[model samples]
Each structure stands twice: as structure tokens, then as C-alpha cells.
Target chain A: MAALSWLEWNPTSFNINNPWTWSPGSDKKVCFVTTGATAPFTALIESVLKPSSIEALRNQGYTHLLIQYGTAKDVFSSCAGAAQCNTRKDSRREALTIDGIDFFPEGLKTQFKLVQQSKGLVISHAGSGSILEALRYQVPLLVVPNTGLLDNHQEELAVAMERSNYLVRGDVKDLAPAIQKSEDFKDKMTQFPPITSGGHRETKSFADIMDETMGFLD
Target chain B: MPSPPPLSALYSLSFLLALLTTLLVAASLRLLAILPTTHTSAPLAAARRKHPHATRLLIVLGSGGHTHEMLYLLRALDPAKYTHRTYVVGAGDAFSAQRAVEFEREVEGRERERARARGDGDGDGDIEKRKPKTEMETETQAQRDQPTPPRTLRTGPEAYNIATIPRARHIHQPLLTTPLTALSTLLYSFPPLLSSPPLLPAQPPQTPYEAAAADLPDLILTNGPATGVLVVLAALVLKFFDVRGAQSRGMCKTVYVESFARVRTLSLSGRCLVWVVDRFVVQWEELEGRGGRAEFWGVLV
Candidate 1:
């Protein structure tokens, strides 16, 4: 077997006070949000941009809010204006820069890295792809399922993942509570791609399954 | 004998119905025998030793979410073992195809780094002849076209190829025309399933690698995709007829992984293929045995 170069970030060992970490604000705390890539969860985008959610982020001492809004540019722009207006009026809240991205074809690698470096949070739609990618960065994740879709599987997946402590499930109608939970959830969240389950059942990787299916001795 | 009452009148309606029922029953029995039961993870070392030269693996990449999970699932894919990789993508899915190439390059790059770390002297001449050519190549043209430094490891362009098949159903396509499109997708699936294209065009495979590349894949891996369902069906058809010794030679063994998003219920494609594929794996514990065969191995992606 050849050695693999997968970069794994352990949140437990990650230091939040690393001064060398790159960010606009030296001590910035960021909260990144990703709506679904293809369909674009309008409700999630709208919910995250609501002033309440923004206030929750501010309460957590977050310095930046970045949203991957997908195709909901109109919805994002409309809600973002009012949310920014409310934030600007509050003198007590420190400067929180809000940003939006329509889409990133190559994925959110840069955005996730930014959040990881800042010891920030990721709020994402409950699509498996986004959740899987975000969790790999070892950031606190809050997953919101698009309830409008007919299939309830996304909701089920979020529930199961949350139960396992992999993420916190957020509601599309209100994301503030989940956002508030992110502060404490950061330290206790379970690892992504868990190495084992309950200690009794043997776990096999997808690679192992492939070799076994092919009858490969190794 | 007046052609036995013109043949149409010879058999009664009930008699014809009986014959049809008998055929259907026989087919059901055959299907039950062909479809694998819950497969144990223990490797069949004896079977593997019989065909030790080369192994070909076919991977089906679907739309965005499916493609994303498929790549992650194959992150640990070993090129040295599965010498030949044929990636099947739906027509017009350039994203998936591009990702496949990127994944291959990433693997090659990783192995090259390992060689450098091991203090194997890195030079064009030294790397070129590092390992004996795994495949017997008679084509001087292909050898010239090969770009990646060879001797480092068994990976890069020569080890893998990408194949494209027509989409089973396009979004917004009318339901009335779906079956027709699906039939076409099923028909197109056979060529890739039979064998990957020869490494170089218009040439028969000369080396062991090329021979395996042009032969039926040892395994077919798929997750949730409409096209995947059609491809699996095509493989089943080939096995049903024992085409080119597909069944006898232990080829076209399929393993379907239910999407990680599917925690409690199977997707439409998962439900469709659950009964037929060789192995059905799910990520969540709750869905471990839904179809009486779904194996849970924790979260793969």
C-alpha cells in the first residue's frame, strides 16, 4: 500500500489564538454559510440573512459572515441589505463584514479553509456533499434542510448526523438558535469519517470494500 | 394438414398463457440465483489467485452530489492493484470527467512524492526503468505518447480511461418519453461494460494491462444515479446471457453504495437496484438492513 496525503485537521489540537493565522481582522471569528449548489435553498439563504441570525453571529463575537448563496442572488441581495442596515445601526456590535458568492464551481475549499483557520462555524444546507466537505475542515457545522423539497431524506440525514454529534441540525424557518449553539458545539462535535462505531462492530473503509468485492487478497 | 388450422387457431388462449407464465417463473428463478445475497466481507483469496495478472475496475460517476461522494469514496483507491480504471460518466457531464482526471493526477502526484521521500534517486532515466512494465505493450506509438515518468508507480494516463454514456433522462424531459430515453441509455451502457477502449486507438491490447483493460471489468462501483441503474441493468443482461463468459469468469460484480444523504430511506435508484446488485452498502446504522441486504460500514464519505 502506498502512503496517502490526506490532510486532516484535529479541532481538539487547533489553537484559536494563533496570531499568524491569516484573516482580514487579526482576531476575527467567521461564520460561513453554504446553500445548495444546484437548486439553491432560498429559504436557507433568506433565513441566514435575517437580522436575528446576524445578531446571533454578532453575539458570538463573529467578525465576518460569508454566504455562498448559489443562484439566489436576488434573494440574498434583498435580505442582505436590510440585515446590513440593522447591523450598522447597532453601535455596540463590532464591525462584521457580510459577503455573498453566487457560486464556486471548484468548490468552497478556500472558504472552508478560511473558516478553519479562524476557528469559525459553517452553516450549510443538509445536502450530503456540502456537509461532508465542511465537516472535513473540523469546523462547527449547523445543517439546515430544505423542507420545501418533497424528499424528507435530507431532514432525516441531518437528524441522524446531529444525533451522532457530527453536526447541529438547524431549521429553515429559524437559524438563530442553531447559530447560537455553534459556540459550545465547537469543542464537542464528533469527528468526520469516524474510525469506529460503538467499539464492538468492526468498521471497513470503502477501499477495503472495493478490494474485498474484487476478491483481492490484500 | 392445412398448416394445422393456420397455427393461430392451434393453441387455445389459456394454453398460450400457461407457456408465458412458465417462462416468467423460470426467469424469476434465474434472477434469484444470479443476484447475490448479503455478501460477507471476507476476501475470496482463492478466487483472486486464479486471475492475478491484472484487475480492471469500472466506476460510475453521476450528477453533482453523487459525483462528489463517489470521488470521496475512492480517495484511497490504489492504482497498483486495480491496474485499469474506466470511469463512466453521463453524456454532457464534463464536471465529473474532469474530476476523474484530477483524481488520477492527484494519486500519481502522491505516489511520486512518496518515492522522493524514500530517497529513490529522481532522474528521467532512473524513473523510466524503475519497475518492469506491468503490461506487455507492442505499440511503439503509445510508448512515445506516454508523458508521465513511468518507473515511479503504476498510475497516470495509461492506467485509467473515462467513458461517456447518454443520460438516462434529462431534467424537464416529459415522463412519456422517459422510457425511450432510458432504453437508449441502457443500449449505450453495454460498450463501456464490455471493456474499456484500448489504450491507443485501432490497436489490439498487447500487454497484460491492455488485455485486462479491453476485457470485462472485475467490479462495477456505483452510488445513486439514474444512469447507474441503467448500466447495472445492462451488466445484468450481459450476465444473464453469459456474454463473452462474463458470468463464468467472475466479471461485472457490482457494489452499490447508498448515498450518505439517504439515512433512513433509499433513494429511487437505490430502491430500484437493491434487489439486483451484488452488494448494497449504506452509511447509516438505521438503514443497515432495510432491503434485507443493505450492509452498514459507518460513514464512508
Candidate 2:
């Protein structure tokens, strides 16, 4: 019995048998770009990493870069043969360059490792899964809303996290300044509450509610 | 001059009262159907207290935010307390299963660490033998082997597994196809689930449904999704109409928690389940009663 969904394709599951490791001799700090699974984030990607913007980030000390370009083919056509990164399926980190900036289109099979290994900032579209993963590692995040989405809920989540100061929102057009700002925000980001801040489902109270309601009804 | 009430209005009022009376009677009968019958034979309450069994939680995870929020909620819960947990996820929702498995591994890893610290077993040697030999793992493993490790272990894992229910309506499919698909899902979802063994506390379940009913789960938890709707509805049907003693175990309460993404109102899925679930939890206070009944609380994620 297969779960055939009418919606988006679920990426084939991959097992990470080995734990994440810190890459030795990786002196350059990296900035990672991910547009999420559904929407085409090519426009947002172009806005953030314009030739001029990449230069600005380089000037700010982000030496290495990676991109999870889901359906954003046109944006990186210039870097067509860009070496792919390790996907859970193809666990190889093939580094390639676009406009002289390292872009990994194959996507990393080991994402947590990549997130932890990244020494610079993570620029991501405002999807909750992406946001949560970034926040989990206390990584410096700059969330850019995918304005093309049907609902504006992602915008709401970004604003909430922004209010909480967990991550900064970046304007796609003027991202050089945002790249510079990630360093300052990274330090402040530590002050945000740990994501494990909710209480367990209290069973006794629930049982009590049921008992009381039944009693009232009786 | 005072005008007399219209004859048409009076007729309509009488019709409305009759309908209301019928609905109330039907509701009472439904509730009565699920309630436990006569406790006179024995002190079942006292017996229950003296030998209380741990609750088994069946968590239904939707894709994306639903899984995210459910994970946070589970994080706060004590794994040892819930010895048996079944996570029902949408089919082909590999992401949800992946995340669920990842969470369990993290918890299991932490538990192993804590057990080692207490000198419970020769875990140090076992951990060494079990450590991955991959090129990437060696660097981290070596660091972790140091007298002081940078990471702390997380707890909160017991016995839990993921089950799949077909997506009631495939996304991008014709909208009208949903009801028929949902009907098929309803027929098979619960009976098979009901028959499946509890697997923990190591009790033999008779006629899976009876076994499930005997150890009736305290809660049927879900964060709104199309698949979740099928599950909650299936659970309600079982609770309302027991095939193998759902009523005796007390109706397994359904809790529909709205996604954290919805700041001001319930999603369509949440709206649909609100009519039947025991507790409708919203992450934002502003969403309370916006569409139907709901309980206001802060964000879960």
C-alpha cells in the first residue's frame, strides 16, 4: 500500500547512519540558501545573491556558500555543471561555483551536519520547517518571505520569530547589508528562548475535564 | 397598538423547537452509547486506582507544521509515562516519518548516554563498538570520546512507531473526489488499527479491537491535516459505536490542535473537526471561537 498524495512529491527517505562531523580544515565560513520544498524561490535567490551581493558577503567574511535549489533551475543555469553536494541519496559534497560563488544544487544528504558546520549565516525562505531547523542549532538566520505563496501565513511566522528576535528578515533586493547584519544578529540570537519551551500534554487535567463534563451532563 | 404574533412565525417556532428536541435526544443517546454501563458488580474505580496502567497515546502527525508542533508537544511529555505511543502519519509523507524517526534516535541516544553515566551497563564498550566508521562520523566520534563532550543527551522516548493512513484526497486531484476517498479510508483505518496489538506493557490483545479498547488510549491527538480528519472521525465513530468495547474504556478523547501558522483563525481542517473533537486547541489566543469552539493557549512551537 503506497501513500499516493495529490500534493507535492515527498522526497524519498534517506537514512543517516553516521552522525554529523565537523569538517576539519574548512577555514572558510559558509552561507547556505534553501527555498523550501514547494515554491520556486529562484527570484528570491537571485535577489539575495546577486553578483554584487556575493561580493558584499565575501567582503563580510562569508567565504564558502551552498544552495538547496529546489526547482530553481534558471537561476543557476550559468553554473550548469556546478558540482553537487551530498544528498541523502548521493552522499557526496561536489562543490561548484555560480558567478564565482559556491552553490550546491544537489543538496546535502546530511542537512543537520551542514547546518551545524556552517560558520556564517543561513538565508532561507520563511517556511516553518526551515525556520525550526535553523533555530534548533541556534544558527544565524535571515528569513525572506516567498511572496508568491497562496497564503500569507509564512509572513506571519517570520514576523513572530522576528519579534522574538530568533532570526532577522532580509529584503531580497538589498541583501548585502543583511549579510553584514547576520553577525550582529547571530550574537543576539542566542538570547532567544530555546525551542523546547512548551509543556507536556497534562493527562490528569484532561481526565478531570472529561469527568467534570460528564458529571455536569449527568 | 400592540401587534399579535404572526401565525407563520408561531408555526416556525414550533418546528424549530421540535427539531431542537430531536437533536438533543439524539446527542444524549449518542453519549449514552459510549458511556460505561453499571459499576455495581465491583469497585472498578478503586481497583483502577490501586493498579493504574500507564496511558497509551496515539499521535497523528500532519506534514510540515503539524509535525513540527507535534514534536514540540511530545518533547515536553515524559516518555516513560506513555510507554506505548503510535504515531499515525500520512502515506508518502516521508518527511513526517523521517522527522519522527530522527526525534526517537535523538532521544534514544540521550537515554543511552544517561544510562552509561550511571554505570548501568558496559555501555562505553558497546558505544565504541557501535560507533559509525564513516569518514564523516569519525571526526565527531573522536571528539565525543573525550573526557568532556560538548553535547548533552535528550530524553523522552519509550516504545513508539509510525503508521500510515492514505491521504483522503490526493492533493491536485479534483476536489469532489475527497468525500468518496474519505469514505473508503474510514472503513479500513480504524478496524485494522483497532486490531493491532498495543505492543507495550506486553499484554496479549484479543481481537486487536478488543485489546485496543481494553487499554483504550487516553487521547487521539492531531494537528490539523486532511489525513488527521479521517483519523479523528474514525476514532469518533469507534467511540460512539463500539464494535469491540470502546465504550467500556471510555471514549478516547480527540484533541485537534491548530497549527502555529494560523494566528487569527482555524484552518479548514480544524474547522471541520471542531464539531466533534473533545478539545480544540489553538496556538494563538486570537483564534479562539473564530470559526467554531476552541480553547485558547500560547504557541506550541
Candidate 3:
């Protein structure tokens, strides 16, 4: 196979007017929240838990409300039935919920793309990963730790990020205000380096990585 | 008949037990279905490359994170070689679909302009190639009025197909239902590969080399998310049937990439799929060989 050029944007496969260039803090377009891999997110699936919290967020003017739920994916397989409780019938906006609680929001691409495309706010558990990803994208964030989890370490991570003023840490009980405060943090996200899953060297270009991966095929 | 324990009832009971044993024996014998198709990692991949046709790659785009990482890998893939590609996500994962649509739109936009440029550059050749297929497909679908869009250069065959399969498990579902849900997911992910022949496209290419787009998945690439597990499993099951042609020639090769998030451990899907997947690549060097069949492939996010 010939070496494939990642930069060879054959015009046929490239989008000319990329929408991801939206200015930061432009709008609370998408409020993306996740509780990590396990689902149902404690009170999230049961009793239509936190309907008011979601409402508070909606009231905060997020048009595309994308929330990732844990454990309780079946209940809201489609966004139309998210929260089991009636999501307000607003023709103007949409609420999309994905079950990735145990690995939920697992829509790795869209989540990032959404973050990139709009002033999407990320509300997630305070895992270093969740925090780093949101920050790397320069999205404003809110971190809520699940103390019920085996790792109480997220508490420390949240506290530190909170101290940095990079994000707001909130309890489920106070989700609305926390989301509102995320505005204060979005500007601070530029302070950190882009999250690097690879080692400290210069980041590998898509071309180089493509060659190496395709080499495995050869 | 109830007056005494009928001797005939005892005989009938024994007969039922004997029939049950026979069924169990036959079921065990059917396990032999797996032997013919099972493949070792290295040879299977070798066999795939050995084939002349363009490789078909089914990339299972797990929700959110997996979708992003997989797209990165997908963009890196050689479209010239992997002619036919399927981007599948879990059922009800509109977000994954939304992302895929976004990617496809970009690709389509790119195609639209390139087709125009190609029309300007090699107008006659482009039209001559697309004319027959467009006409035939339009006739087949009975849409004569719609002008044929300039076909994306098949580089090999059909460009891309996107699909969705049911998820293995839902949040907070009962444990007893898990087995059934998983089976349905497996059913959804594959099975079609069994029914459909290699998809060569509308044009009757003179050679399989020209027919690259018409192939079934020669390779399956998955990162994580439970839905991916079904795709990998479906490949294995399809291979077991060795369902004729290139598929029977060998099973589809699968490459399971551990998410970049896993510095020390594998994700659940990664862990579950590791043993079965043909080539398991990890981002963190430290995880190399930590899980059997996995290798460190440097950072690939």
C-alpha cells in the first residue's frame, strides 16, 4: 500500500468551512455532563433524579443539552426519553443523553467535537482524565466528585482544579449554580497545556502515526 | 392408571432421560463449528494483506470518547486500500451518529468540490466511468429524474457505510436479562455479513484489484465501548462459519486499540476484547504485554 498522506485533504473529504472556530464564551450551547463508565449515576436514573438540576441547566440557556449518564442507559436509549421524567417540550432545543456511566459518554469524538464546535460546558466527575480532556479543549468545566465511588481521590483532584479557578466543583444538589459558574472557568482553561496521552516529545502528526499504524498491517 | 406405579411410566421416564442425553451430545459436537475458522493473530493478518482486494474495515465507534479516538485512527487509514468501510455505533447512540454524520459531511463536502475539480480536469474519463453505474443504480431504484451526483472516486469500491447495533448492556438493567441483551447485540453487529455477498459496488470492475470497494471487512478496528465487543465477536462467529470466499479463506482481522486514557489498565471493553482481537495496540508503553496480546504502539490519539 502506498503511504497515505493525512494532510492530503483531497478536497473531497475535507470540510472547507469548519464550524469549530467559534469564539470562546460565545454561548452555553451544549452542557455536557458525565459520571464516567458506570451508569445510572446514583440518583440520575432513579426517581427522575435531578430533573430540576437539568432544568436549571436548561434555564441557563443551553440549547443542545448533551448529558452522559452512567448505569442507566436503557431508560433513555433515545434522547427523546431521557431522564424518564418528562423533559420539557421545547421545540427550539434538544436534550441528548448517552449511557456511558460504566464507560458512558463514550462518544469520544462527538463529545470533543461538540466541545470544539460550540461553547459547550463540560460537567463531569473530577477524574484527572475528565478534567484534562475538558481543559485541553479549553472548555469551561464543572467537576462533581462521587464520594460513593471507591476512589475518594477525585475529591482532591476537584479541590485542586477548583483552587486553580479552572472549574467549579459542585454537589448534585447545587448543579445549576455550578454550571452557571463554569463561565468563570472557561477563560482559565487556556492556562493549561493540551492533554497529552503520548509521552513528552513533540506530538506525532496524524501522518506519522498513520504510517506507523499502517506499518503494522504491512 | 394411578392405582399403582405403572411399570410403563418408569420406562417412559427413562426414555425421556436418554433423549435428553442425546441432545446434549449433539450440542457438544456442534462446538466443532469453531475449529475450522479460528485463527492465530499473525497468520490471519498476513492472509488479509495477501488478498488482492482492498481491505474492508468496520470501525466500531463506541460512544463519546471511543468515537473521537476511532475517528482519529479512521482518518489515518488509507482510503485507497480500505475501500469499503463501516462506521458502527451502539443502538440509541444518536450522539455517535451525530459525530459520524459530521465527519461524513466533511468528507462529502470535500468530495463535492473534488468531483467538480475532477470534472474540470478529466471531464470525459470521470463521466464515462460514473455514467453506467449511476444509470443502472438509478434505474434499479427507479429515480430517473434525479441527476447522478459525481461518484466519489471509489479508490477501490463503495466509500463508506454507517450502522448501529444494540448495546450489550443498559444502565441498571437486571442481571438475568444481560445474557439475552448481549446475544441480540451480537446478532445486530454481524449476521448481515453472512447474508450479503462481498459488496463490490454498482460497477463491474474487471479485477478484484479494481474491486477493492466491493469487499467485506478484511479488518475490524475497535477502540472501546461495549458495542465494539459485538463487532469483534461477530467477526469471530462469522469466521467460524468461514462463510465462503475471502471470508472462508480466513477470518476478518481485528485490531483493538486501548483508549489513551488507560495508562496502567485496560478499559473493560479493551480487557474483554484483548484475547480475541488480532492486533491490540496500546497508547502507554507501560501496558505492553501487561495484558496478553497487547503491544505498545506509542500515542495514537
Instruction: Indicate the worst ten consecutive residues by lDDT in candidate 3 chain B.
Output: B43-52
Per-residue accuracy of model 3 over A1-218 as CA lDDT, tens digit each: 01122223244332313432345566536666666653335443332235666676666666555545544455435442554335545555555332222232223455656765776677777665566666667667777777667834567657655664667888765576776676656665535442334555545433343333334333
List, residue by residue over A110-180, the lDDT tens digit for candidate 1: 78988898888899988888888998888889999888999467888888899999999988888889888
Query: Per-residue lDDT tens digits of candidate 3, residues B100-174?
Result: 767766655555556543444334466455555665656635643546432335432246666767888886789
For model 3, the stretches where C-alpha displacement exceeds 4 angstroms are A1-218, B1-53, B110-158, B195-214, B245-251
Candidate 2 structure quality by residue, lDDT tens digits, B1-301: 9899877875697889998999999988986655333231121231123222344567788876688778866664444334456778877788788888887777676666655643344366554556555763666556567664222232334256677877777777797887888887776578434743454556666343334334556567788878788887788777776745655555466667788777765688987877666667676557766544566544555
Candidate 2 reaches a DockQ of: 0.16
DockQ metric for all predictions = 0.44, 0.16, 0.06
Error of 3 at A151 (Å): 5.3
Please give, for residues B3-118, the per-residue lDDT of candidate 1 as tens digits: 54556654889778989999999888877767775554344332655234677999999987899899999998887678889999999888799899999999888777656533
Return whichever of 2 and 3 wins on DockQ: 2
Which residue pairs of candidate 2 clash?
Answer: A6-B170, A6-B171, A86-A92, A86-A109, A87-A109, A88-A109, B195-B208
Q: Per-residue error at A51 for model 1, in Å?
A: 3.0
TM-score winner: 1
